[model samples]
Target: MTLMKAVTFRDFGGPEMLQLTEVARPEPGPSDVLIRIHAAGICYHDVLSRAGKIPRDKPGQILGHEIAGEIAAVGSNVSPDRIGERVVIYQRLFCGQCPYCLAGRQDLCRNSRVLGENGGGGYAEFTCVPAQNAIQMPDGLDMTTAALAVCPIGTSVRAALGVAKIGPGDKVLVTGSGGGLGLHQIQVAKSVNAHVIAVTSSDEKVDVIKQAGADEVIISPDLKFSREVWRLTAKQGVDVVLENVVTNTFGESLRSTAQNAKVVVLGNIGTRPVEVDPGLLIVRRIRIAGSGNATYADVRRSLHLLATGAVKPFIGRVLPFPDVGQGHALMEQKAVVGRVVLSGW
Candidate 1:
């Protein structure tokens, strides 16, 4: 029996719960491929899971989803020639026959499951995923950059370009603008010629958000930035808003939009519910959309953007495989500027 090293939590409470363990090496199924993971991105989602917030991440389960690697082995049904291919893993295992998948909107696939929560997660030395979930890495793109393609990058693409449909000269406001998703979404919004206003709770991240292409940065530690947003836009407000910090800033995000603004809620950093003003929605004709995940096409677009230098990935720190707990600590403290990517087994 072959054993591989993986990071798993015996109990979900603290970063210390994440411990290295030897586990059975996973073998690919008939339609899957075994990948030798080179990089796995540590998201806030992982930190939440460690804190017992995400129920899908069971105790003792491997916990990382953003992954990039080389195809080391192919399943019986997969072509042997595909081995040695460098690829970025798509996080969801979507059933192709689902109605959403049939419409090429697999982002909403009902039968889909997230990789880290439901399958062979990437915290280990290797992981097995369906053959179709592997997206070829663009030429000259490194593993670390590819690791973020499907997550913050692709996710931002889906929210800004696809869901919000941001266009040239559109006014875009991004909440949590210094976060992993915000850094990339700023660039995505700018790529479409939008004027971006970045909002962050930390003053330390103000300059970082501007460096990431925010036309304006608002340091709103108290989560009240709507007034500044309105003043900056000359009372016009923004045309689109990408709300990455929903739990704390949903009301402000809604209040900071124009008459017919499109607001895309990317995540609720904390899972707690927020109070919504239905009157504000009715008066402004505000359209709020929630994106659970990105489509395969969004991942492909993110890769192309990365390759062409349209969107540069921001990695706060890169840790070795065994130091994954450190990444979680940094995330919990909100000390990382962008993302924490783990590499070097």
Candidate 2:
């Protein structure tokens, strides 16, 4: 049995629970590819999982999803020549024969599971995933940038375009606009020529939010930004609201939307519940859709936009693999301006 260095926590608690240890290297199954992980992004979701907020992400599971690497080997069923291709992982495990997967909605597959739950994850030097999940990174896209291709970027694609159907002349609002997903979602909405209004809880992030292509930035540390949204849209409200921080902002997001507008909820970082007024939802005719993860097509679109520079990844920091605990602290404190990617294992 070959051994590889990996970061995994035997018990769920704080970032310190994540320890460096040796584990058996995973071998690819018949339809899988062995990936030599070059870089991996630290997502807020990882922090939540580490705190035991997610029941499915079991203890001892390697916790990372935003991955980029080169194929180091292949299973018997895979072509040997493809071993050297650079790729970004698709971020989910799914039964391919499911109806949703067949229709390209892999995120909605009946058997869908996050990669680290039952398989090797990107925190390690190597991981094995289905061949179809290894999306080829476009030429000139660095490993760090490609590491974010399927996550903050691809999920942005799903929220802005796939769910909200944002288009030219649309009024789009993005909450948590200073964070990793927020900055990318703003850029994705702008890529399609939408009018974007960004909201951030941190006053220090206003300029960075603006730099990420938000037409307007509102600093509301207390989640009191709906009135400002009303003022900004001239009482018309926004056509779409991308709610990345849904715990405290769900109500605000619903209030920030126009009649017939779609509100796409990407996450509730706190894992806490928020009260909602059904009457307000009814009167506004607001359609709230929950979105997470990305399909193969969404990842492909994300890569194209990234490769062409239509959307630039906001990489705030890059730490060596051993500094992953610091990355978790930064994410938990919401201290980073954008994505934190880990490499140099």
- Clash count list over all predictions: 0, 0
Residue-level lDDT tens digits of model 2 in 287-344: 9898888778899999999999999999899999888999999888888999999999
lDDT of 1: 0.91
| Backbone clashes in model 2, listed as residue pairs | none
Model 1: per-residue Cα lDDT over 166-283, one tens digit each: 9999999999899999999999999989999999998999888988899999998899999999999999999999998898799999999999999998888889999999999999
TM-score for model 2?
Answer: 0.98
Cα lDDT, all candidates? 0.91, 0.91
